[model samples]
Target: MADPKGFMTTPRQEWPRRPVEERVRDWHEVYVPGALLPIVSKQADRCMDCGIPFCHHACPLGNLIPEWNDLVSREDWRAASDRLHATNNFPEFTGRLCPAPCEAGCVLAINQPAVTIKNVECAIADRAWEEGFTSPRPPERLSGRTVAVIGSGPTGLAAAQQLTRAGHTVAVYERDDRLGGLMRYGIPAFKMEKHHLERRLEQMRAEGTKFRPSTAVGQDIGAAELRSRYDAVVVATGATAWRELPVPGRELAGVHQAMEYLPQANRVCEGDLEVSPLSAAGKHVVIVGGGDTGADCLGTAVREGAASVTQLDIYAQPGTERDEDAEPWPTYPKLYRLSAAHEEARDLGTAPAADADARLFAASTLRFGGDAEGRVRRLHLVEVDAGRRPVPGSERTLPADLVLLALGFSGPDRSDGLVDQLGLELEPRGTLARDAGFATNVPGVFAAGDAARGQSLIVWAIAEGRAVAAAVDRYLTGRSRLPAPISPYDRPMTV
Candidate 1:
C-alpha cells in the first residue's frame, strides 16, 4: 500500500456539480467538466485497502478498487487505467451511472464518509481517454467463429467487444436507428453526454466489432434464421417491458409510462425530434414511483420547464444516515441519497421546502381524473400507513396535467418475438431463464444482462456481458481463456 496512513490524512471529497440554475438551462451533465481530476488522487488516498475489501464483494463487476486507489495515490495513472480496464469493459458508463455499491461497502463508510471511489474511477477513465491510452485492441489471430449479439446496451457491447478481442467475428445488432441501445435513447444527455458513448463506439468499431443498427432479430430478420446463420448467438436485450400503474382511469391520454416519456426526450437530444411528443413543458407533472427512473423524469421535466413536479412513493421515508441497528456494516445500506436530479429539484423549490425533497413518502395514487377530452387533468392520492393501507381521511387531489408511471420495468419486451421465436424459457419473475453458464435452454443460445437478470444497474449489465462472453467462448471452443466475473444467477445486495 502506497502511503499506508493516507486514509487518515485525506478527507473524502467529491466533484462539485455546476450550479443548478446554470446547468438546468442546458442539456449537459451537472458536474463541472474536468472537476474530478484535481482531487481524485487525494480522494484515492482515502482508501484503507482493508484486508477483506468488502467493496470487491459489493461491486457486481468485482473491480479492483483498492489496487486502483493505491495506484492513483502513487501517481501511476497508466497502471490505474490498466487495472480499471482489466475487469470492466466500460468504466466510463458505470462511473457515471452506477449507484456505487462499492462505496457503500467501504470500511470508512462504517463510520466516517467513504472513499470517493466512483469519482476516482471516472477520473481514471477520463484520463485514459484524454491520454490516448485506450485504443483498438484487435486480436492477432482470427478464431474463425462468427457470433451474433442482440442489443447494443452495456451488456451486448461488452460481450461484443470481448468476443471481438478474442478473435471472434462479432456482430452487434441493435433495434434502434443508432447503436448503444438504452445508453443512446433511454438515458438523458444531462446524466451522460453522447460523446462518451460515441468515443467508445469508435474504439469498438476499430477493434473489429461490427455493428448492425436499425435492425432486430425475430422481426427484421427471423430468429430461426439468425440462429442458423451465426455459429452462436448472445441475447443481451435488456428488460424494457415497463411496469404499469394499474389504477382507476389508467387509460387517460396524458398518463404515460416513464419509458415512453424518457425515450422521446433522449431522441430530441439526438436531434431526431424538435421536441418530445409528450413534453412536460407548462405541465404540473405527478411522477408515480420514487426510484431512479422517477428522479430521471423529474430532471427531464425541470429542463422542459414544467410548472410543478411531485413524485410519490409507497414506502416510508428512509433515514438520511445509515441505521446501523437495521443495516450493519459490510452490507449496502439504503441511506437516503440526493441525486443530481433531486438536488436540482430542491434548488428549484419544487421539492418540499421542509427537506427539499420532492418525494412524498407513504403516498399512494388512488386514481386519476381526466378532462372531457380523455386527457388526464388531475391525480387522486391517499396517505398510506407502513402496511401500504390507505390512511383514514387522507384522500386528496393534485393538479396534474401529465402523469408518469416511473414504476420501473418488469422484463424484456417480447413484442419483437425474440423469446417466442427462439423458444427461450423465462423465469417466474418474467426474465429469461439461464443455466449456470449463462446459456439458455436451447443449445448455441445464451442470455445475459437484463434479459436474463431482469432490470438491474449498468454495473451488473457489464458484468453479465463479460461473463456471458466467457461462457460463449467456452461453448464455441473445446477450451477457453476468458475470465468469467460471476455466475449466471449471482446477484449483488440490493441497496
Candidate 2:
C-alpha cells in the first residue's frame, strides 16, 4: 500500500474526456491528452488490495489488478507494465476497448465506486510505450516446431505472439490486407487509434512472428494443405457473420450491415481509401441497434456530417442503476451507459438533445419506405413491449437516407470456405466446435476466440488465444509449459 489511508483519503477521479462539441468534428480519441495521469495514482491507490482480489477472477485475462494498482500508486510504471503484460499480451487494446468488468468486480465497488483499475491500466500501458519499456522478447532457442494461426484478430495475434515467444515458428494468416483483423478495420479511430495496433504488430514481427495478410485460408491455401505444412493449426478467425435485420425493406438502398459501414469509415480514416462508398455525409442516418457497434456508427456518421442520427433498440431501456436481482454484486450490471458517441450526439441536438443522444428503446423497425428510385427515404417503426410485439397504434415514420444495421454478429463467416474445406464441425450455435483443449475434430487443428466462442470482449479473445496456444503446443510436442488462462468450462466472474 503506497499510503495506508490512501483509499479513505483520495476520492475517485475519472479520466476527463474531450469536450463533446470539439471531439465530434474529428476522428481523434475522446479523452483529453495527459488527462488521466494526474488522478490515476490516487485512484489506483484506492484499491483495497483485497484478500482475494476478485478483479482477477472478473477479468478473463486474469490481470494482476491489485499488484498493478499498487505499482501505479507508487509511480513504478515500468513494474506496473510488467505485471500487466504477464497475463495480457495487449494491454493497450484491452485497456481501451474492454468495458472493465474487473472494475465492476472490485471489492471497493461492493460499496463505493470502484478503484479506477481500467484507467490505471491504460496509464501503465501508455507510459510503457512512451518510456520504451515495451519490447519484443524473442526466445533464446528454437523449439523446432511450427504453428499456423488463421486470422489476425486479437486472439490470433495473442496466440501467435505467445507461441513465438515459446520458441515455436508461427505464421499468422489474415484475409484482410493488413494485420490486426477487426482492430485494423472494424474499430473506429475515435475509439482507439490504429497506431496502437500497428505498434504491437511491429513488436510481434520483431519477435519472429511471420504475418501473411490478404491470404484467405480456405480459398488461397486449402485447409488441408495448411494443416500438412504446420505441426499445429490454430483457428482464431473471429466471428464475421453479421446478425442481419430480415425486415421487409432490408433490400432497399442505404440499408447496410454495421460491418459493411464501419470498415469503410475506418479505411477512409487510414487514408487508404480516398472516399467511403457509404459516406454518411448530409444524410439522415438511423442505426438499428443500441450496442457498441451502433455507438461506433453514430460517431462515424457525426464525423461524416450526417444531417441527423438515431439509434434504436428493440429491448426496453436499461435502468440507470444496477438491476440487483438480475445482476447481483460482482456481476456485470445492466445499467444505462453514456458512450463518447452518445455524448457527441447529445451536444449536437440531432435527436432528443435533452436526453443524451438519439436513442429509442422499446422500438422496432417494421419496414423501409423508399423513393421512386428505390433509395431508402424513410423508416417505418412501432413501439413494442417486452415480448417485442407491436404495441397498439404506435406506428411512426422516421426519415432516413442511410440505414446501418448494427444488430451484432452471429458467428464466423463460413462462406470463405475455411470451415467447409477443413471439414470442421460447428456447434449448434454456429461457432466452431472444439473439445476440452480447443481442438477441433480434425487432428492438429484447434479453434479459439470468436471463431470458437462467438462474439465477445477483446480480453476474452486474448485469453482464449493464449489458452489455445498452450493446447496447440501440447498437441505438437506431446507436453507443454504454456499457461492456459481459462479452461473451456471455466465461468468468468463477470462484474
Candidate 3:
C-alpha cells in the first residue's frame, strides 16, 4: 500500500467544480482544468486494496480499480492509464458521464467516504492524453474478416475498436448525421464537449476502424443485405423511444419529450440550427421527471434564458445519505444527488436553488391548460400520496409555457423500421432479445447496448459493446481471442 494509514490521515477530497456563475454562462464542462491532479494521488492512496475488491464487481466494465489506484498513488500515471484502459475503451467518457457505482462498493465506504476513484480515473485519463500516453493501437495483422457494427454509441464504438485491434476490418454505421450516437447529439455539450468525442473518433480511424456516418442499415442498406455483406453483424442501436406521460392534454402545444427538447439544444451547439425549434427562452418551463434526463432539461432551460424553471418528481426526495437498512454497504445506495444541472438550477434560483430554484417533490401532473391559440400556458398538478395518487382537494394550477416530459425512455424506437425489417424478437420489456452471447435468433446477427438491455449507463453500454464484439468475433472466426467483459445474461448488481 502506498500509505498504511492514508484512509484515516487524508480525508476524501473530490474534484472541485467550476464556480456556478462562471460555468453556467457557457457550454464548457464544469470542472476547473488540471485542478484534480494534485489531490487525486492522495485520494488514490485511500484505496484499501481490499481482500476481495468489490469495486471491480461494481463496475460494468470490471475496471481494475484497485490496481490503478495503487499505481496512481505511487505517481505512476502511465501504468495507471494502461491498467485503466485495459478494461474500459474510454475512461474519459465514463469518468465524466457515469454515476460511479464502483465507489458504492468501495471497502472504505463501509465506514467512511470512498476513495475518489472516479476522480482519480478522470485524472489518470486526462494526464494520459496530456502526456501523449494515449495513442492508436493498430492491429499487428489483418484477420481478413469484415464486421459491420450498427450504431456509433459507446457500445458500438468500443466493439469496433476492440474488433479492429483483433485484426478484423470493422465498419461502424451510425444513423445520425454525425457519429458518437447519444454522446454527440442527445447529451448537452455543457456536460461534455463534442471535441473529446471527435478526438477519440480520429484515434479509432487511425487504428483502422472505418466509420460510416449518416448511413443507417435498414434505411440506406437492407438489414438482410448488411448481414449477407459482412461475416458478422453487431447491432448496438440504443433505446431511443421516450417514455410518455399519457395524461389529458397530451396533444397540447409546448408539451415535449425531454429527448425532443434536448437534441435541439445539442444541435444548436453543433451550429446545425440557428435557433432551437423548442427553446425555453423567456418561458416558464416545467420539467416532469426527476431523473438525470429531467435535470438535463433544467440545465438547458436555464442556459436558454427561461423565465422560470420548476422540476417535479412523483417520488419523495431521496435521503442525502445512504439508508443502511434498506441499502447495505458494498451496494450502490439510493441517495439524493445534486448533478451539474441541479447545481446550475440552484445557482439560477430554481427549486434546487438555495434562494430561487423551484422543485416540487411528491407531485403529479393532472392536465394542461392552453390559451385561445392552442398554446399551453398552464399545468394542472396535485400533491400526491405515497402511492403517487393525487390527494383530494390538492389540485393547483402552475404557469408553464413549456412543459418537458423528462420521463425516461421505455425502449428502442420500433418505428425506425429496422426491427421490423430484421424480424427481431423483443423481450417482454420491449427490448431486443439476445441469447447468452448477445446473438439474436439470426445466426450472423447480434444485438447489444440500450437497444437490447434498455436504458442504462454509458459504462454498461460500452461493456456490452466489447462483450458483443467478442461474441461476433467468435462466430466469424470459429473461436475468438477478444475479451468479453460480461455475458448477455449477466446482470450487474447496480442494474
Backbone clashes in model 3, listed as residue pairs: 346-353, 349-356, 349-357, 350-356, 350-357, 350-358, 351-357, 351-358, 351-359
Q: Weakest 10 consecutive residues, lDDT, candidate 2?
A: 349-358
- Scored against the true structure, residue 470 in model 1 reaches a CA lDDT of 93
> Listing every candidate in turn, what is its Cα RMSD in Å to the true structure after a full C-alpha superposition?
1.3, 1.3, 1.7
- Ranked by lDDT from best down, the candidates are 1, 2, 3
lDDT of 3 by residue, 1-495 (tens): 899889989999989989988887887888988789989999998998889999998898999998999999999989999999999999999988889989998989988999898899889988998889888999999999999999999999999999999999999999889999889878888878888898899999999999899987788888888888898888888998888888888888999998889989999999999889999999989999988888888888888889889998888777778888878877788787788888778766754322224568788999999989888998888989989888999887888899999888777787657888888999998999989989898888899999999999988999998899888888888899888989877776743
The digit string of per-residue lDDT tens for model 1 on 22-137 reads: 99999999999877888888889889988989999889888999999999988898999999999999988988998898998998888889998899899999999988889889
Residue 248 in model 2: shift from native, Å? 0.9
**Highest lDDT, which number?**
1
lDDT of each: 0.90, 0.89, 0.88
Model 2: runs farther than 4 Å from truth? Answer: 353-356
State the local distance difference test value for candidate 2: 0.89
The TM-scores, one per candidate, come to 0.98, 0.98, 0.97
